[model samples]
Target chain A: MDWNKILLFSILVMVHVPIVSIGQEKLAMQWENVPEEIVQGRLEPQGTASFQRFPQELQKEVREPVWQLSRNSAGLYIDFESDASDIIVEYDVEDQFSFPHMPATGVSGLDLYAMDENSGWQWVRGIYSFKDTISYRYNGIKPAIKGSLRTFRLYLPLYNTVRSLRIGVAENSIFKPIKTKEQNPIVVYGTSIVQGACASRPGLAWTSILGRYIDKPVVNLGFSGNGKLEPEVIDFILRASPSIIVLDCMPNFRDSQKAEESIIKSIERIRAANDTVPILLIEHAGYSDGFVQNERLEIYENLNKATQRAFTYLKSQGINFLHLVKKEDINLGKESFVDGTHPNDHGMVGYAMAISKALTEKEILD
Target chain B: MDWNKILLFSILVMVHVPIVSIGQEKLAMQWENVPEEIVQGRLEPQGTASFQRFPQELQKEVREPVWQLSRNSAGLYIDFESDASDIIVEYDVEDQFSFPHMPATGVSGLDLYAMDENSGWQWVRGIYSFKDTISYRYNGIKPAIKGSLRTFRLYLPLYNTVRSLRIGVAENSIFKPIKTKEQNPIVVYGTSIVQGACASRPGLAWTSILGRYIDKPVVNLGFSGNGKLEPEVIDFILRASPSIIVLDCMPNFRDSQKAEESIIKSIERIRAANDTVPILLIEHAGYSDGFVQNERLEIYENLNKATQRAFTYLKSQGINFLHLVKKEDINLGKESFVDGTHPNDHGMVGYAMAISKALTEKEILD
Candidate 1:
């Protein structure tokens, strides 16, 4: 109740106002620049972006505020502003191996540098010494290049900012391009594994490996565990209009009945969109033998039978479909599995080989 | 300033005391039941449960508190307290599919019922009437089964859990006893796809299909896009003591040099922990020509070469390994893909066939 105390309290209250105001301002700024809504809940067609998964302990430590998309409309654009002169742009080069703790070692690296308008392009051997870092230092020197409205425009002369930057490494690179009369994109829609989980390198993923083999672009729509046959996602597939549609959602459906019905519905939906689009149905891979017993095996048998029936029905409907049953050849026993379900690197390679063989036998690819 | 006003205010204050006290007491009662540790963020693992992913929004809506596994515990346990006349328990069933949206529609359903307390189980037919829903219901009325433990376990339950749930469909349904020889407990550690993403059914996933073929059980550790090569996860694999380890963390790695290096390191770590374990390496499936261009194709080449080189190096060191290169059979033409990346039902089938053939040729299975 003293006058001095009152004055002190007043000063403290006044000091707290700006702090609260600054906090509000910061929150407002974040809300203003939220990630672009490509497909609202799902990824949009022809959208380009990267996601990083963190360990539970370090989830809050890594901060990636800016995300850029490489689109046909305009060249790569930094979604956020950065004042740092020397910025490290790190991204997972492989399809599935993006763990923070595991850094690439003893692999070829690439560093790309685009000089001013008069100077030509310069390339240097990138260093793969850093455990988890990819950096480019500009020394704050702005390029004398013009800006364009197009997202795909690689206009080098008017490049004021870091435009047209790409890193190419040899060990993790794709095969040489194969000239073909016709090239169609392959659409793989299924579980997280389909989306490229745990593959040590990008090209090592079955999808990516398939892409390199065919020398064509592949639209990867494998959204982690969210690959349920949602009507909206099917709509996206329809919109994308790929050459083929692969449905690999068995791992998510524990009940064979549900899996059978969903497969039928998904096939119907795709057939509704495009009758002749080749739709391949794959069965779930091997899990640890300990979890599934005789009863579980019976259930799996029922599910397998139902799947076969669907395949038969689709074939009767004159729909172009392929059924890949898990024979003894492709079984991953306890020794084959890294944990009990997901395949480790060796398992991935084996799986990719199996897929490649299937495609070859069916004469689906060139 | 007025005596009458002051008196009225005092009377009002006195009247409000009991009302406020009662409300406070109720609030305090609720707080008393709340554990102090939970309030202080020191809850046990079982006490902290993950928020369920909403199928439509793909966002975490509510957090369901669950008991965590105690330290040094071999397995996970979840308990539900219910006294209703009829109780139906449900939990996410993972590894059926990588994602929740896509369901495997063609596979049959399996149901196992425990006939006696410790005897082998009996088989029950699982009905697939509903769409994307697997349910079992209780037929007869009975007393509340106290301390009755029901473990809806799976080899790769992580991926399927996104949209899959193992529910107590019927009351008085016998709990099935798992067979011993049928238990091929292998732990799968990979990305989300291995966890079962957009799979259509529980049986159609490659992992599940393989499990059926081999007559073994699998533990799915496919963590969607987060399947980076982490040493801790590898350590978990070692402790699980699976016979084989399948490495399929390629798609998540993209085409980074760091990812290539990590792939090698992860393999080495696993081998170092336990030698003579069969490790299979998989390559990503090639993309359709429509989706990617020459530059991107080059990226795939680099990654593929890196994988081959790593495999060769590992072999030189006398490591038991297998490689699944992407065959040029499935071209990235219009007929193969639904979108650029995800394959439809037809694609899944083709993938399975390819994998099956490769495994047979390599003699990895059987």
Candidate 2:
């Protein structure tokens, strides 16, 4: 056995397991449970094994990697109303702290946003400490008015698994979980970029940004590197009763042959389940490194061409409610990416803007 | 005295000490040393104790924290011309791997950019691995023509101290360092934001972004939390023969009185040394959390008001070639920040654009 490797790994884990420390002046607070029904961005919240994306029944039905990745709380957020001037958030995640390209802030950190009476949604910044149990302290949050409860949305980690969660408000303050209606949400089924690859915070993710922009629920079914349009995943997405279904899995396709085949199959399966559901197909946002590497450029060009062919074939079969988002439509500049592949917060903004523009143009969102 | 704490610290140090590994298909190459004269961003390159920002003479003059931070390679980058299709970069940084909010990619990672013959500048994406000796492998670079050498610029780490660095290319490829003329470069002296804090990568820093837009060299003298407009630091700025001097230290000032006094003192010191250099003063870019926190909002408003008073006081004293950038000029939206304090890559773009516009409007840069 390689003791060196084991020793190094153990040390890394120990170092990342931060010791939770509360400052000298601790406020008196009443803790409340996060009601499962109030969680947005999940398709089957009730049937999940924990606070995860997939249902318990589909665990054995999907690929090993897909099932494992489904455990991540990507795009999941809690909606609530609070009158507390100071709030405390505590949660536990079942994964490593961070990645090389992405930070812990986006990987496992919690993001808070409050709805302002006059200025729309505003960000709520807090002092956070990581440990066996992660905690966030938000002090002196201004009321929307002089003295009234304000609506607050707290976004979960984009690339980590939530083990347990709770919220604490000032003693005697009102805290109510906002229950979501059965509205057909805009469903985004895509790759890591959609899963918030390198966004500095959860709210900056394209899906989250789009949610605030259209003022609607956005169900994120983004799987990192495993966003290939398989029947099992598509089956799960169809169950959401989506108002607008977006498929953006072309970047996962290494070749045009696979991309074309998957696009046709995924769309056909979706249409079989619901014939009139509006669907949006997206082309690969070309890599920033494409300018200096011909092979990199060709990957996007070929995938886009194959997508066009699939769209043409589908139209010939008399398929309606299908729309295509071209590469030009996304319009990511050379400076839009972190590592030429994953869109940073800058590129994430571009993604949200592009999707919003497309949906508005198609009259999908008013 | 604390055995458990000592053990934990030792373990963390061992875990971060990366083991350097090379791929199986290693090609034969020749390495070239980075010329110190070609390194941009440092205030003084020739007489530094090492490849650092400050000269050896001022080692005892500045505060301890400022002197320690001066060793960091925040905005440093190397300019060279190469015809090699593949490039390898290797370096060592003397610091912890990363922060809770900022990843290793920004804290200690290297970024590369190549000049396109037709399309201006392009980003060169590379596969990187971190260790005690970190390395980057960039393969299959496309030339302007079939056999032309391209101007390649490699940016160093943003928040770490560079111990050593080296570059490798094909055995017979032409490699040349670009010698910079002593043209008066824009000198930016301020706080952590100006020092490339929390940027996803070095190239995404506002100073680097502004460098590309104006196609001119920019010297960065940002000193983390120690940009207090001390006369010792201001003395170094005057030595740079700056075409334009930008002061953006309002964020570091905790109170309005301190901010107003420091601004006046710093500007006076710079004027006393060099009378005709164009000086631009920047107001604090308000925090994102200010929308929900009145105290946070007041911090920016007070600092900005104090800055305005300082600017007015200077102008009344018959000070010429002085400019004040209002808070509105650098418009950072609520969504612009990463942790409500630091600007992410998206916000970095906004910052660069604002500064570039200010420079152009003042006829400082064509």
In order, the candidates keep a fraction of the true contacts of 0.00, 0.70
Model 2 chain B: worst 10 consecutive residues (lDDT sum) = B11-20
Give the top-scoring candidate (lDDT). 2
Q: Write the per-residue lDDT of candidate 2 for residues A98-191, one digit (tens) a residue.
A: 8888889899999999998777889998898878888888888977777788999999999998877778887778889898767888888889
Q: Tell me each candidate's i-RMS in Å.
A: 16.6, 0.9
Give me the displacement of residue A71 in model 2, in angstroms: 0.7
TM-score for predicted model 2 compared with the true structure: 0.93
lDDT of 2 by residue, B16-134 (tens): 22232346665666677666577777777666633468876778999989998888988888889999888888777889868888888899998999999788889999898889988
List where candidate 1 sits over 4 angstroms from the true fold. Answer: A1-366, B1-175, B179-184, B289-296, B321-338, B352-360
User: Residue B37 error for model 2, in Å?
Assistant: 2.3
lDDT score of residue A277 within candidate 1: 66
Judge the docking of candidate 2 as incorrect, acceptable, medium or high: medium
Residue B256 of model 1, lDDT score: 58
